[model samples]
Target: MRIFLLFFPVFFFCGLLHAQTVKVEYGGDPLPDKDRKKIEQFLQHEVDFYSQFGLPDTLSLQLYVFENRREAIDYLESINVSLPIKASGAYSPKLQKAVILGRENGRERSLAIIYHELSHHFVSQILGKRPPSWLNEGLSEYFEHCTIHKKAVRHTFTEYEQGRVRTMYMLGEVNLPTFLK
Candidate 1:
């Protein structure tokens, strides 16, 4: 019993050391260092948020940004992600990667896409398998609203969105059976 107690703290500290780590790799067009650092910071915020649900020992993320939709589509296809005609971003769990269609002037939208894709990665890490599309896409949609402030990250629906959801619920438009199907 004394030996067990002696090793317990060591094991606990080791687990904390290996808790979780995230590495980001960029491909295709070169990302500016400033933008890259911001993206990494946002990812770190997301990693910390999702850590409550548990994570793997290490998470390696590959991010590919393409200036053209065709190239992004082709790249995602090569990795076996069959994106629809108008997908702006996609995450591949098998490759631990995300491919995005870049818009030079849309920084806010770009961050939203990054957050959404990272949510998919976290969900995969937690569940070890894909959940239903409704749940998966719903989570991504909700997480896309996250904004990284200087001191914090925040994700919340606007009042309009809250009203819309409330109206939908009041009208019984939120069909759980069909959604779960």
Candidate 2:
């Protein structure tokens, strides 16, 4: 009877946890509906842009827009990642999320940051949470640049050849054992 009573609350609490909806807050400049619509359009463009690289279609993405760097830092602090930049924007793969901090005063800058973060999101999804650190960071940088230039392949290969960036070989072996380590 004591065992059953102890287990009852555990099961009840688990049920309640599963039934909860996740609420996300976006801090920054308040985006008007019209601007938000434009942002969505830019996101779609990024999607198409990344698709050219043979990225999988199963990856899902969400974007949160913040008004400025301070608000972004505040929100990021809540999630426990260090803020290393004045950051026009940032991405969080664990949350399956990207955040754009600051307004789209212009299309080019806004779209660039969005595409960069979206690239990170997709890479995280494709690698199934066990990709190599170098590959992960390199791919994210590659996609960020590609989004900026609308290129199919960016400077990654060249950068690797020139020693400007670490090669996949130096990134360690591409096996699960090496990668997960």
Candidate 3:
């Protein structure tokens, strides 16, 4: 009877673990092991980042890492049943998940996209609410320029590529103000 009582609670607790478990469903082009590990680590960090705010749950999030933006957009459009943003990554509120391009120029670019999308999920859960769209997106962008050192994440602001920016502006490129009418 003593053994039965002890084992029964353990068995019940196992099911609770299943209920809140996070599952990353992968589709599209095959990714190298290196990229896959990066994705997993970033996702784990995102959960820990938000959980620090004393959320009741562990901030479970699903990540879908596509080999390119096309595959990511295709996945989003199919599930969203609406036009998906044509971008490196996006967070889906309906699915409570993140879909992102796993590689572009390099691992750093991919890491930036991962952080940007993951931040969206983090802010919403950590604060038990979301900030305005502009603030949320700005925060994500700021976090995108981040570095992980010895398990510590540090965000750094980088100026836009100096040489390229100067050349483009010299060649008549302009920064137009956003006009929403």
Candidate 4:
């Protein structure tokens, strides 16, 4: 009877460990079936693209599409994070989770945000969560701009040169020395 009790506790613990499945919740307007399909395809493609860099595929990332900024802000706050946040999406290394809030009519922008956040996710997974600030933010921005055409890059560069868009160094938000190094 003593041995049986010990073994039962072991079995119970093992079952509990195995039963902890990752949960992904979407807290916003339900996407239409067609849009959901497109979002899934896009996510798969982004996952594949990042996989080439040897990032883990075990992320189990979840996405949320909020109807408006107010709803999105509320949801973000509910998640215990502050807002008017710089990034459109966030990757929580501790939680092994990612949250993306889509603008009501800004589907393309939301997709870019996904790419940006996933870049963070992949890098964090590969580097074990302590990637330098500059590399982290720059890489996220780089991935966000990955799909831009060559002409667009050139135009953007020109704008930067003309002081329309700020330079990386000028922004000084990221650690330029570490990034350049």
Candidate 5:
């Protein structure tokens, strides 16, 4: 009984390491310290916004930024999932990590994607359940680009998603009320 009790604590601590509330591991690509700080600041702002809005408390998620899609995909595939065909960034709730393309898309887009994934993480906490694919995707796209201007918050939609909505509106496929609901 003493042997089992001692080993159990060791196993529990090991599990805790994989579930860090906050961790960001950079790859060999060498992200500049300036960029890293900016990213952290943006993420922290998101966390604060959600907390102030009466959502669940903040969550700690590990972030992995690789130099390119290949590296990201390789690392992702090493996990139990299949390779992503054309993804730049993603949040794996099961793993509690965000995997992203570090160098390829440049800072603006990369930051947008990171915010998008992190938004998903928080939104999941709000619903306390997995949202439908469209809701998950729409909310993420809505949060992908956030800007504060003169005490006003603006959210920019992804180009593809925005274009689709515009096209639908033009074609009378969607009306304001239907879209809102």
Candidate 6:
């Protein structure tokens, strides 16, 4: 009876986590309703993908979108986060939030940035800890190119990635086991 009582809450909590809805909130500069809807759809797709592995019960995601890099930097400063000039987006694992420079780039590019940052967010949730930097960034980058459809999902490498792989192959540095280690 004591064992059943001890284990019951664990099972109940796991079930609740599996059934929980992912709530998304927006902040910073306001976005158009159309854009917001699109982002929500994309995030829902990611949420569905991550759900298979399990998620926290309080899986709320906050996205802060700024009109340009300057605004993005300013918001980051307000939050005491130093912005890197080259970064198009950032994810704060501590806050379960993503910050992005929106509209400066085309729609596709902006979506890719969201994809990358949200990948980081979801990965953090599933692992319950930050993954190694290389693996974290690699997975995020991979998801940045993913095309998720109702019936299918596909991913492709960028030209830069293709060239990098080719160079690595030429240099004979393409050892999978070594890279994994």
Model-by-model lDDT, in order?
A: 0.70, 0.52, 0.60, 0.55, 0.61, 0.71
**Model 3 global lDDT (CA atoms, 0 to 1):** 0.60
- Per-residue C-alpha lDDT of model 6 across residues 88-127, encoded as one tens digit per residue: 9988888777889755887678777888988899889988
Tens digits of per-residue lDDT, candidate 2, 1-181, equal 0001000011111222331111223334555665454444444544454455544534445566665556766767878766545667777767776777665356556655666676676666656665687876776666555432233333323354446324445675345456436
Over all chains combined, what TM-score does candidate 1 have?
Answer: 0.74
Q: Residue 163, candidate 3: how far off, in angstroms?
A: 13
Per-residue accuracy of model 4 over 72-96 as CA lDDT, tens digit each: 6667677776544565666777665
The alpha-carbon deviation from the true structure for residue 115 of candidate 6, after best TM-score superposition, in angstroms, is 1.1
What is the overall TM-score of model 4 with all chains considered together?
Answer: 0.57
Please identify model 4 stretches exceeding 4 Å from their true place: 1-27, 33-38, 84-86, 148-181
RMSD of each: 11.3, 14.8, 12.1, 13.3, 10.6, 10.4
**Per-residue lDDT for 180 in model 6?**
45
- State how far residue 163 of model 2 sits from its true place (Å): 16
How would you encode candidate 5's per-residue C-alpha lDDT over 41-160 as one tens digit per residue?
Answer: 555556555554445432555666676677677677788655355767777767766777555777777767777877777776666557677877877777777754444556756688
Lowest summed lDDT across 10 adjacent residues in model 3 is found at: 1-10
Candidate with top TM-score is 1
Candidate 1 vs 4: which has more lDDT: 1
**Candidates' TM-scores?**
0.74, 0.50, 0.61, 0.57, 0.64, 0.72
Which pairs clash inside model 5?
21-60
Which wins on TM-score, candidate 1 or candidate 3?
A: 1
Q: Runs in model 2 with CA error above 4 Å?
A: 1-59, 104-107, 146-181
Give the alpha carbon lDDT tens digit for every residue of 48-114 in model 1.
6667667665777777776666777767767788785666788888888777776553867776787
| Greater-lDDT candidate between 4 and 6 | 6
